[model samples]
Target: MRPPTRLARAGGALLLAAALSGSLGGCLSAYLGTAPEENSPTAPPSAPPGPRTTAPTGAAAVTAAVTVTIGNFLFQPANFTVRPGGTVTVVNGDTVEHTLTAQDRTFGTPPIAPGASATFTAPAQRGDYAYLCTFHHFMRGILTVA
Candidate 1:
């Protein structure tokens, strides 16, 4: 068959452009809806794995401290207790960076790189303190001081 006329070619190009734009718009919306935010209160289903290390500082330097392990975007022993003003050591066993941040802003750790570790001191007050990973908010745990 003979090649299409110029008008036909232009029409075809416009149709293709429209289709691509629609698909791309849909993808952008999907990403914005699903991608996690820094202040998000939920965690993704999983995280990639890798290895890194960080030096323990502040309360983590204390020899006597309770251990909290992070893996699979979940905190081990999601609930635990410590003495008021006690030291708590956070071990990052996951392959991604994470944080143990108190909801009340009373205590929190720096971003603990994968396979790295950090520490924070428990609140001196007697009560339950809820915490979560600042990066992955869904990864949460409870710390009680009594």
Candidate 2:
């Protein structure tokens, strides 16, 4: 093609690329948890991957069995009430890796492999603990100690 025509074609291609990038950036931002609308209260949050709180006595003092399963980017139960001295075992049921990390200086299990399990003892006090998968920051849960 003539030099002038080729230059015009190249300019048109560059403009198309810029437009595509701008639109794609917005979609990528939403996927990366940067969307204010997603965090808004009007949007009901998903259930945590497991219970946030554990009993004081762990599972032994409770009448019901307490087991939390982690898998498929979610925590089963997502929330639980436990005694102060309770013990909670986290079961990693997902094919991918996950962690039972807790804030507030509470106990935590190491990164768990699929089909592996980790147990943590509850503190001798009532409080709430939030946890999530380290790899997938969006996966979350809470343990409520009573």
Candidate 3:
């Protein structure tokens, strides 16, 4: 048989590329974290595992005046209330260290090691604030200043 023409070879390459792109698109959920730059080459084999999440059952919401717990890879009482400019303490119950990284830079804390505690002063704006563990950066929670 005659070898394929140059036009035929180009068409085959385009068909192969289309098929590969379609397959990769279906696996986007595996990369659920913050989307990086479009041309960045630092992606994982799968959607680099995300943080463990939990809904606030009000479990630690009332503990010892605005104290929350960080243990078992979750933020107990995923949300809590605080007075404007009041203190919000985080008590770490896990062996690993954690942080209360303010998403808005309103407040933050140094590392709170296992069985330790750290406090962040609530913003004075009477609004809800979001935060996460700088260490985990996925263990998220909220603080409401009213």
Candidate 4:
């Protein structure tokens, strides 16, 4: 058999390069997307940005710590509400990992390995917030504050 010609070798190299760049592009986007903007300075520490309030701890303390479990390719209690200024604890009940991501970029968790959990303060407002498991498109949920 004859050795590959220049054109063939160039084509192969181009294909390999394209494939690598496609995958690496994804990685770069993910990293850049999550990184804080270098040009945008953070807000003053004395003045907090969002309507951050302490999670209620009172007669509603028992209900204040809400839990959203992830398993079966689903967010158990796919829809639920909690009082404003409360805590939402996302528990990964599945054998595989999961993520609790807010569509509005208001909040989210890094990958929660199986049986692990992440907790964040609910938005201090009275409205509906939609979220999803970034890893699983079909896995979604709603958080309501009223």
Could you tell me the TM-score of candidate 2? 0.54
Q: For every model shown, what is its TM-score relative to the native structure?
A: 0.56, 0.54, 0.55, 0.56
Measured with C-alpha atoms, the lDDT of residue 67 in candidate 3 is 74
Total clashing residue pairs per candidate? 3, 23, 2, 0
List, residue by residue over 12-49, the lDDT tens digit for candidate 3: 99999999888776666466645766667885445667
- Return the lDDT, model 1, position 60: 46
Task: Find the 10 residues in a row with the least total lDDT in model 3.
Answer: 55-64
Best by lDDT: 1
User: Each candidate: RMSD to true structure?
Assistant: 16.0, 11.9, 13.3, 16.9
In model 1, which regions exceed 4 Å deviation?
A: 1-64
Model 1 has a clash total of 3
TM-score comparison, 1 vs 2, better candidate: 1
What pairs collide in candidate 3?
30-47, 31-47
What's the lDDT for candidate 3? 0.80
Give the alpha-carbon lDDT of every model: 0.84, 0.77, 0.80, 0.83
Model 4 residue runs over 4 Å out of place are 1-62
**Candidate 2 or 3, higher TM-score?**
3
